[model samples]
Target: MTKQPSSLTSIASIVASMTAVAIGNGMMLAYVPFALTRSDAPDWVPGAAVTMIAFGGLVGCVIAGPMIRRVGHARAFSCSMALVILSALAIALGMHPLVWVLARGLYGASGNTNFIIAQSWLNHASANHWRGKAMALFYMAYVIGLGTGAWLFGQIPADGNLPPLVTIFFTALALLPIGLTRLPTPPAPAKVSIDIPMVWRNSPVAFIGVLAAGGLSMVVQGFTPIYAAANNVSQGDVANLMFVMQFGLIAIQYPMGTLSDRIDRRLVLIGTCLLILVAGFLALSATFSNLILLMLVFALFAGAVETVYSIANAHANDRTDPADFVPLASTMLVAWSAAATVVPLMVTVLMPVFGPRTFIYAAMAVAALYALFVLARLRKRDEVPAAERESFELKSAQMPNAGALVEAEARAE
Candidate 1:
């Protein structure tokens, strides 16, 4: 009989895969719309293209669980990686707007499933005590990978086949670690179902918090570069801005995560939204005028925006049974992706008519509205007992169902 690889081995493999693909994925995110804008495509195309990626993500979340159940986790992961490579190649070979849109859609589906595979694997491997830190490390890996990719974007010329070719290299590199690792895949997932009402009942704050996170985060990630470009920021500095935002996110991750463990996570969620409002106001004031100041404030804004999903996840997990983790996560992702899908398109369509600062106004409105919702929720439910609360972990905002592995363990218990 084969010996099971230790959690340490699984973690190494998972983090390695996340880091590698994130570099590629990060580059792709910036490259797609930036490329569209540079090509003098219609203003709506860049945002429309971004919306397609989000739409693809919604499709990915719906399918990833069942795909893992059908093929088994390891095989499912391999399939997603294959798609990643193929999509990147398509993007490299063709710059036609239609081809670019289709390639990005493929990348979005496959890329999101890839992360879901890794996160579910990591959660399965980690002990309860260690899961928080392990997850935080995983989050850090992507942040660093993305930061590195954005920095490289500044240095590399966008012409020719070089950008997507480089993305393909990293996507290919991601496969090596997973292929060699002996770590076991999580027991196959059960059939997937998204029960949004169940999740809303589990934690109303989490339900709304995720929507707030998704809507604001998509705007930030999808449009920040385009917004920067519209305001006359240089291409290289735009890359630097992306890098700085990631740096800000990482710097606060540990502190915010640990604090969520100590206090009412709802309170933390409220504070985070407030931070977003303040940062949005600052960013609008800066209006891409002072690159240095904008970067500084945007970092704080990004940092606050990034933490909402994780804190809300922790809050929801506190109220939920481990047995329900899989479905609860699915529901949450659906909520997130639903918001993600519509919000960017709204900003994109309005930006040309209302001007570039539209994203700032929309993001601020989201944060403000969410904060008010949390305030109402706070008056309704008492805090979960401190002892029952799960320790917090940093989670990616894009993919929702990271808790599937926890369900198997819950069943075994």
Candidate 2:
């Protein structure tokens, strides 16, 4: 009886900590790009900064498993949080483009590593019977925190250093919960080898799908402020756009996952791609003049686009061996992070020549190409049977340890 209550308390502490950092990350997501657009930096600098962040995320994934093993979860989490605060302060104080790049890199590294620690700790502490519920709660924390932060971005007066300072405050707040928790630190996450080739061999669709999902979703979330700034959108409206789009991303996850569980997951991916294409068409076809309509289309688009990572991940796990689950998780995140790194650089080159609409155009091409590829593969491979398929969970590229948790749940069952 006591075990259950204690487990719940520990899980709650982890969630609180995760939510605080996510709020800070959400603010930085909007602030960085918008600030760059207003600065004298070249058009490509925003994309470059994002690319560096992705690069740092890859670094985080590599280091997290070992870092936790060496220092334990509580200490590792604190260290990562400290790095986040440092990065935020750097961004707050620095005006140079190179400084922004370095700060964003550290931000990405710490943010990704911190999430891995939080989720892993939550997984370790959760009672097996209700682990799924704990994970669901964890998912909600991220979405709520991120959305709240974006909304706060709009609410905060942009006067002087207030915006970045508020972000620093949230990052600082994250340190208190986990740092002070009475619960014991969870065991170190086991080191798993990541192999991209193995991922491709097991599920080509998942490989490509996560890549597309990561790239598309990252661009939509990370670069939208740049697009708005380019189009002369007010800061308040830009923040509103981010809030609405994030809401859409959160709203669509379960419905799509539930629907995917009922039928072929590929079909769901196809539908999501179509939504992306439709959103792109809407954006290009004079919808920008009407803010409400534009927001609706973007909301729809974000919901569909962001859901791709989880669906693709579930699709792969359906076909993967239990022994390989950890590796699969590691590999897919690598794929996701890699695409996130490369795609922004590619898009930025075009954005400079074609203006803001180039973002929409690049997204359309990715959607069209990914949809076609999935279609081609469908003819080559039959769908995994429903009985054998893993129940879909709402997932994000940020939560790199989710697949390992899924494996643990299966073992618990």
Candidate 3:
């Protein structure tokens, strides 16, 4: 990623990354929603199929790093696309539960690597100071993919087998850019011999913030379709419910990034977690009929937890040197992916006990727990001198203080 190649290289990387995620996430947004409202499938079957796919996805992340290194990213990523597209076509032709599991698992396992590696590539090109913005853009691509998929979700017919065929076609649509681009194969991260401990000792806020963000996002994504379905909503409404979450995803990052730049990223992070706390409460309290209100509440929650990981990234950058950023970033990305895998499995089991709204309660509880720890860790940081405090502020603040001389010139004028 640090190769400093042509702007087309950068553009290609971003486009490839975003497109891969859009199609990969297209499966995510569409899979459960389709299964939920389909005339042929039962309710629990959707959850069962998704849980297996997610588990396969979890296993996929473990091997992706080494696989990317061994075979190179382009081939690795392209193979994943082929597998996913083929699987979608198979599912489209028929309605076998086992094939649904296989398609989705292949989709999950292969889907996240391209997106993950793309971020690593983007991180390589970005300066540490601007990395927060860069990472925000990278992560936003996933949300945008999800957003686009939800809108596209309706184009799939509501009949027994048609939706899978639509999914297969769009899945192929997302692969075209990669096939056309003349981009060089991006380099993989260096293999880490050590699983460095206490890396977040100075910035516990960042450590927990990211994990919690991953947890909340995975839970909602894995199960929101189930929640909407049990409430008697249509497939389109389920798509829109996921879209509302993506809407939250796109709407929150810039302001949060700006606030992190201005004040302590830690506080911005904590404040966002608190927002999730409120959102979780509101989200859990609602009955089946209140879909619109639930959408608004979860959207607010999405803004808080989803984008806060970028702030956590900024905070992590604060304590490390330029050289360590890439390795640390790879580690953090792994950590987040690992949590994203586990969160759904744990929460899905809760659905039978707590009803389909398990994601809400679980997200709220996790957010509150992480928020409290972050605040506690931040207490020591609060005692730092005012001068020292500003030193850790985002580098963007050192510019002329929002047009300082303009006021004096206005008086002269």
Badly placed stretches (over 4 Å) of model 3 are 1-3, 8-10, 13-17, 20-24, 33-45, 48-54, 121-138, 192-198, 287-290, 382-413
CA-lDDT, candidates in order: 0.79, 0.79, 0.60
Cα lDDT tens digits, model 3, 353-386, are: 8877777888888877887887787767753333
For model 3, give the 10-residue run with minimal summed lDDT. 396-405
Candidate 2 worst ten-residue window by lDDT: 402-411
Winner on lDDT between 1 and 3 is: 1
lDDT of 2 by residue, 262-362 (tens): 99999999888898898888877744468888788788878888778889988998988877777888787777878887887788787778887776787
Assess candidate 1 and give its TM-score to the true structure: 0.93
- The collision pairs in model 2 are none
lDDT by residue for model 1 over 2-39, one digit each (tens)? 23344554578779987998888878777776777777
Backbone-clash count (model 2) = 0
Which has the higher lDDT value, candidate number 2 or candidate number 3?
A: 2
Q: What is the lDDT of residue 210 in candidate 1?
A: 85
